[model samples]
Target: MLTIVKGPYLQWPTEDSMTIMWETSEQASSRADVLMAERIHSGYQGNYKKPEHVVSTVSNKGYCTIHQLTVKNLEPSTIYFYNIYSACEKGEIESGPHPLKTAVRKGEPFSFTVTSETGGYSGFDQSNGRINRNIFHQMQRYRPDLTLFVGDLVNDGQNYDDWEKYFFRPGKDFIINTPFYSCLGNHERNASWYYDFFAYDPPKNYYSFDYGDVHFICLDSTDFIKPEHYPNSAGEISSGNAQYDFLVQDLEATSAAWKIVFFHYPPYISGGYQVEELRKLSPVLEQYGVDVVFNSHTIVYERSHPIRGGQIDENDGIVYIVAGGAGAMPDWFLPKREWHTSQSLAVPHFVQVVVTSNLLELRAIDEEGRLFDALKIRKGTNGRKEFL
Candidate 1:
């Protein structure tokens, strides 16, 4: 049988186009037809204005099993419908007329889901699996435009079977439609699977993207996790290198209305794995006016008061959040750190962020569908912020 093993997921959507990728069990030629939506619908429907198709076929000696197709030349802030067709020996396999919205306009409002350290393989519990299901259903209801998965997607990211069971299979509800942009976690351990499975905007481990008047920096924290041979030495932003330099320059050059950064490690967090040296990022974030920082690894939900230069600065400090409770194990606070205004390991959870020109709204919800915490960040002209 010709089976799609994973994906039909989307990647970053630009003003004029977007990418849709998938993999099948056997080698095959694939094609996808893009159709613009004449009118908005509450759900996916076959009401497309016309069908625009893009096709790909295997060459001479090789059979291609993976497909990444880009649907191009569409209007900004508009939605489109598309279906995938793969030609194989048995028959033509077809899927969807799924709905996808193009990139929002400059000042438009957009929202996305964020979470990390989803439960790994440590002590797989039957009950914990149910928690993961509940959390995913909650996310599905929200229908986030995209999902920012910080790290530790699976307990063992390198093993295909592990991902298939825990991450991909369990997340099928939302993964099919919501494009997941993820960073590396220590547990990934420099696995090639992480790179092969997902597509990056800049096609690098570390990169940035701009959406809806917001500039987002997705950094790699797994660089130094492996001591013997560090796979991502460039992420050692302390010393001058491409990753570090890119981060500095990118933050400096961005004139977006809001700036946010996310990764697997928190520069400022309280836990056994806490590495003080990661604090190197604080000065830079403060210098360039980063509004918030998101991280996951410690398996808890934590939110710090806006901090600048390692000190609580309500007027200008960047708020740091640790939201790693998808399915992985849970952890407790190391101590009552001065920076922590709220901390919880009561349940597994994820964070949802919505941004517009003047405000950034954050809501943390646990697996049981309870609101853990919330913050409303209001911005003034350019550099000013009206703290709440």
Candidate 2:
């Protein structure tokens, strides 16, 4: 049988398409059945109302066990029930009657979680695994529609061992059905391993997507830092380069109510690392009136006051949040610069963001289920944002 090895993780869910990705033990042909389920009663009885105009694309020929199947032409803002089917020389295997939700309509209210520095199995003992599970469970309780993983999903840079240890197992319950997008951290150092494991946007490691009233730009921070370590297309973040060029064009073109950017490093923070490439993009971010920026690599939790042109201006700048609290070994305060830091703490936590047509609410929750900080950004009809 085509034994499942990793994932069935949901990805890039849109009005008309949602991708289901998984890894298997051997080369195999795969298929999925998309059905509509309608509530009948208290016991959760629902009908298997089959969907039409659906397309499934699979690579049943490659020696690589990674299988990415996108179910296309689905109804907008709809609910779906699906089952995975795979065929191999050993046998045929099936998974789930899982429920999936498509994108919300524009102007609709939505919620999602943002976090990095996760699944550091080697960084902790068996009991630490419980801490990882605890943090993940707490976030899951919030029931986010999607999740933005800033980076460091595992401890080691390259290998299936690290993958299974830190990420695949702990994330099984929450990530499988949730649409998970990512940024590349130092831990995901191997070009082939990082790119091969988690699926993001097409062609390069950076890309933008829209859901509800928000447009999200997921970037790879290591692009300019370590060009020698990745593909030629991987680490280009300078001006006029592919990544920077894309950021300019992408932000210039987006008309979403809220624009949020995420990457692995903080250009200005008390993190373990900082860089020119990331700091260089701050102007670009502020220039476009990007609502907020999320970053990781510090292994601490910090939120800077709204900053514009390198200064805090509550009414005119974007808030930079450092949320490296996804189970990685703690890297405490390097040194906080008093001018911009509103709050900073060493903890394992995640940020939950709720977006509406007029508001963006963020909450930081720790491993013990404490809400340490909360911020609200109010958006006027003219598209200007201010802290509330």
Candidate 3:
């Protein structure tokens, strides 16, 4: 079967660099091809021209294959068409003429998409899988600039073949065109397919990138230890000392207008495992003035009020959002805390975030094109706190 998975659009230090990724069924004979073309929008017709080709290699896991392609020296804020293909001695099998756009140069305003909990669910009914597929189709209508996959891209992370059957086949169109970004989910931690297919900076598991005025930090949060083997006090898997140190240095060094962090697990959650193993890193986030935290894994959509020192502090608190509804089925909850301002127990969904000079608007839309939740944060001047 034909499959497609994409993301973790890591921006290289240079203004002209970017990383693109995807996965397929069996390994292709050679590398996949990528073509870029300018976007032309007329009164009633839109066209793409000037195809530029790039090739990508496949990383293998049994019969499954993960593919990655990094394109550099591209113009910022420009739209282009791309595609993937398999080349062999006989001929080439093509995937698409999809489209994507590079991030705007530094200091310019831009928008992107963040989603998670899409495919695969153990113990839950197969209906959960169908819900995720529906959401993926619906999300395409918005045509986001970029897409960040929070985690659990597939239910059986160990089954590379399943990854292809479940995720890639359903989202190929979105994957080929959009510069997708990603993080490791608990499901993904069981195998190396995710890492092998995605081109990340050194130390792979954790890295940071800058786009426009925003600094994006991606972290790995799978608790690898067996639940029965660990003591109650043991925590979730975290970025060892090396990753932590890198984050400290990166955060301190960044001079962007916004600092955003995305990971598989939530530091604070009301269901399906509460509190992250890396709670120790919360202090570092607060100290660095991280503007927002995007998390997944609960299969539910929830957002925390601005919090500081482990408590709600509207003015100086960091906004935490759990966009787990991307495709996974929702979990039952009674809302134990006030931090859960908005939630949806209906269809699976994803989030769309738009950042302007004065405000950051967050919109949660479900598979049916219904608005489930929304919130906004206004930026403050003079380095003081601003409330919604």
Candidate 4:
């Protein structure tokens, strides 16, 4: 039997609750066991082993199944090494000895990595081969607390084989230890494999997670608003009403020092696509006071100036980043006059976000370990602007 494919770890509402996901080739056993250890060492040796935690079987597809195990009563900001395995009468198929660190208690500082546009094949010369290896290598070097993928996990969303190959072989090591979050891209519109692969609390395409003093909101932009729906009119943001509603509630409910949103498409991009296409959802994002928005569809690295209500506003505007270069080839498009794009680069890269009590630093790093662009956003006071 093929080994279990682990991936797409999304944090739960609380730090104690965590959602784990994995896939198997054939049906071996119905029971799966999760073991946790505290204060693990580098070489995977320690006296940190929690009692075995049994998870309930939630759903299953033809050869894929999803199991959710919620671990409660965990210490804040602590490291927990865990393993998952199939329980059988004769023996078991073990996965792990992997380790994960819980979110900081509150008002603490942390760091994470954000990347997208990986695991795809546009053509022969533009394959995402190097991007995959580079990202995994960077993960090993950085060992970030969390990882977020904006979209395009696979070239074709319906191709289950690609998903298994891309994530299982290349991304398994990072997913097992660090909690990876994901959003749906245009490529995933026709595929249901994402839901089957990742076990989220709400069982929806979009969700929110809180770490340290920031709230990360993952959005599904493809189905939420389609270009076809608005023929004579511009595009309408109706792909995922459930997601928009959730966003409203999630943003209002959080009092974090920073608010960041990650999605597949750019609301304001200088790419080949039309500009008015993003007008539909611009209002909602502006109303909720989103600090930064990270997007990845164009396969190019571009950053826009602060934008609010579809206009560039430096003082109280959201910083938009297009980081589609995870593994996709760079697009050769220039910025339009209306975009007010501050900086643009066609390099394939990923972003490293470092969060502190007073400020948030975002660095766009390319595959060659070069910094393409850097931005420092300071925290505001009582909804007022605060600058460096």
Candidate 5:
């Protein structure tokens, strides 16, 4: 029997392109049939139109179990429905008629969800698998156009089973429709599987993308990992490294209205795990006008007061959010509140960020979809930000 072992999921979405990938039980060739649509669901399920031709990949060794296809020539900020088919020796297998929307143009409105530290073992008494399951369910309700995963998707990136049980199986329904971008976490162990499964632009580990008016960057934070765990992975985000150069060049080039960066280790946190070395990048982040930074590792929810030059500067400082409660074992806030902490809690939750030309709103919701915190920022003349 022919079977789809994994995926039928989305990735690396651009205004005019979206990549669809899947794994089959046998070596096979694949095809994607796409149809452009106006609305998300037009009360029409049975309608079908001739599809635009898709671009797919076949293994260099004739045929392979994995199938990947990039659907192109799409219209920006438009809706499209697609179906995937895989052909093997036995017969043809089909899935979808699924809906996906292309990236919205600059100054347009869009939303994305954020989650991190989702890769811990359930039995570790640190993180619960049930919470991961519930959080994913809640994430789908928001219908985010994109998902920004801070890091640690599996307990052991080298262990294949961990990927399926800890990450994929729990996130299947949510991931299929929502394309996500992730950074590397310590728990990933710098394994080969991490690189093989995802697609990115050059220097894959640290990359950036744009949606609407927001410029989103995901950095590897390689300094956090021990040498033995990542023997051959030498990428670093320090001031003198290549990753640093990319950050400078990319930040200087983009003209997006809002800038957000994320990674696994925190430069500033209310907890004990803060990486003092990472403080060196703060100047660069501030210089480039990064609005917010998301970090994970410690399992706690923390949003620091906007800080500039090591002090709270509400008028112009960048906000740092530690959204580490996705599915990791909980970590406690320090015995004494830190000067930078605006709000700190140890709860499993996810954040939804809605961005527009002049405004951005963020809401943090727990597993049950109850909002715990909300923030709104309005931009005025001269790119000045007023936080409400």
Candidate 6:
């Protein structure tokens, strides 16, 4: 029937370009009709702008069921509407005049949501599937410019069906408009599908990008999650491999006003699961002045105090957050709180971060869409922060 089997979703946005990707039931050629708007009317009473036509570049060989089309020369910080069409034996089928926005320029304001661990495979009520819809819709309410998935997208990385059921299907609406960047988690099992589905820059599994004045780095921390792995033995940074070298270079090169890093396993947590090896990344992160780090895999929500050298340094230390509460079964916080824990909670939640010129605000909201924790960091001379 040449139906779309997946996404007419957005990804890897740039100030001058936006990439739209989708998969069709049959091998086909694709095209899109785009409309740029100064302002779009909220409902059916339509008021819009002229439409622009764009063609898709077939991304895969053979049938060409997958299509990735990058629309270029777009105006920075502008809103646009687009609809995709696929051609095949069943004639042509069309989808969405979906809305999207190009990246904002440096020093401009923007917001993004952070989440992960939606791969739970238990029964609907017991697994992440139960609340994923609610949480995703909650995220959509914030209308974030981007979404950061810290990892563990599915329970079994190799299981094709799980990706569809656990993530893509539930998050379709939110992801279609809000582009997302992701890392890997142990549950992903280092599978090929993870690479095929997400369209990121080269060396896909680990890469970095800039938005406004914030530098965002996504690293691969899955290896260290192995039960037997210990410090200096495994992990993206601790293994002393390409990823480690890349981390150093990436951090050194960026002069962004704020730096945020994302991975899977928690190096610091008050939860049951903790990977000792991931802690090896602290020195490097602090040395390069990373402002904050986000992680998932513990299935709980936690925020660490500004930590430096294993101690809290409110004036100039790095803040670590575990925002693994997407759709996984909630885990309890250990009764014995750790010294570095600033806040700990057992709930399925999402984090929203708003970044302006010198101020960053973070709010953690639960599945029911209620705020539970809030943090604000005001940047000062030489990148020092005054947290409130």
Off by over 4 Å in 5: 37-42, 45-62, 121-128, 223-238, 328-331
* Per-residue lDDT over 1-388 for candidate 5, one digit per residue giving the tens place of the 0 to 100 score: 7888777788998998898877778887787766654333334542434334443222223456666678887888877777878877876688877777789998789999998767743545444478888888999999999998888888888998887887778888888888888888887877887787787775678889888899988888754345563322333545567788888999999988999999888877877677756766788889888999998877778888888899998788898988885654444567777898888777789999999898989898988899988888888768888889
Question: With candidate 1 superimposed using the best TM-score fit, by how many Å does residue 36's alpha carbon deviate from the native?
Answer: 2.9
Candidate 6 lDDT over 24-107, as tens digits, reads 888887776566544456542145544444432222233477778887777889877888778877766788778888999998
Query: All models: lDDT?
Result: 0.74, 0.77, 0.65, 0.67, 0.79, 0.82
Per-prediction TM-score, please?
0.89, 0.90, 0.82, 0.84, 0.90, 0.92
Better of 2 and 3 by lDDT: 2
Global lDDT for candidate 6? 0.82
Clash pairs for candidate 3: 4-168, 7-180, 7-181, 8-180, 8-181, 8-182, 9-181, 37-81, 120-155, 236-277
Residue-by-residue lDDT tens digits, candidate 2, 138-247: 87888788998888887876766887777778888887778888888878774576677666677547899999999999887777566464322343556778788989
lDDT of 4 by residue, 144-213 (tens): 7788888888777798777765655676667666777888877766478877766554545787877888
Estimate, for each residue in 1-388, the C-alpha lDDT of model 3 and write its tens digit: 4443333222232355455554444554323334555456632114655566553333222333455556666677766555555443444455555555667776566667777866534346456456656667767777766678888887777787666665666666566555667787777754776667566675666788877778899876653333453313244333565566777889989877778999876776666655545556688899998888988877777787787787877777887887876544444444465454434443577888877665777888887888878878777774445755
* TM-score of model 6 (CA atoms): 0.92
Candidate number achieving the greatest TM-score relative to the actual structure: 6
**Model 5: colliding residue pairs:** 126-329
lDDT of 1 by residue, 153-185 (tens): 777777777666667777876777776788888
* Decoy 4 TM-score against native: 0.84
Two-way lDDT contest, 1 vs 6, winner: 6
By TM-score, the better pick of 4 and 5 is 5
Query: For each candidate, C-alpha RMSD in Å?
Result: 3.5, 3.5, 4.6, 4.1, 3.5, 2.7
Rate residue 376 of model 4 by lDDT. Answer: 88
- Name the top lDDT candidate: 6
Each model's backbone clash number? 4, 3, 10, 6, 1, 1
For model 1 the TM-score comes to 0.89
Model 1 global lDDT (CA atoms, 0 to 1): 0.74
